[model samples]
Target: MDRQLAERLEIFERTGQVAPEICRFVRTELDVLDAAGSEITEESAGTLTSHLLLALQRSRDGGALTEFAADETVRAELAGHPDALEQAAALAERAESALDVVLPGQEVRFLALHLALLRQREAMR
Candidate 1:
């Protein structure tokens, strides 16, 4: 296991309330971010991890956030960054498979935004 993942798992285990599956899901996303060299800030990681875990829990509970529709403004903005859009779509596909839930385009756009923001942060650094 990656050191980061091991450390994260340790923390999750200490929480005593996290399900093993949730930890696996979080670890998967963290691994993906690490593999892509995306270094999100600790705050971002905490927020993203919480959201991802909640999403997975909802999926498992048969109550996915299915009503979040992407507006044209979001689509238009994402169109400006074709690469980010494409990468996000691909990542969303993997996330769907991993979570066994079909995320709405808005959720996928959120993922793109996350990646774009992370990349922008890296560029700023």
Candidate 2:
């Protein structure tokens, strides 16, 4: 995930505008996921599922890194539906597992946000 963020940060850094907002959001999300990963078992699978769905939607809204043209291979892979979502969800699940073990009693508000975002994306689609 850090690798993915590094790649995205590099792209946004080149854009020279909206860098702060994008950087902050991406970094925060990464931090939350990292925290979740560190203590996942306490989290519910449904929560992780929700987060994956929302993340997919947010990815769509934030341009999803799917339109760069230069990274057709990555785009195609992500566009393959379940494959990308599954991989991302798996990561979230791992994070949830970690969160459960270390940060027990935590709420998955982000997951819910992700789900809502995904639903909006689907409606638009």
All candidates' lDDT scores?
Answer: 0.64, 0.39
Per-residue lDDT of model 1, residues 24-93, tens digit only: 7667767777677776445445555555555555666667666655556677877666777677678667
TM-score of each: 0.67, 0.28
Q: lDDT at 48 for candidate 2?
A: 42
Instruction: Write down the TM-score for model 2.
Output: 0.28
Q: What is the C-alpha local distance difference test score of candidate 1?
A: 0.64
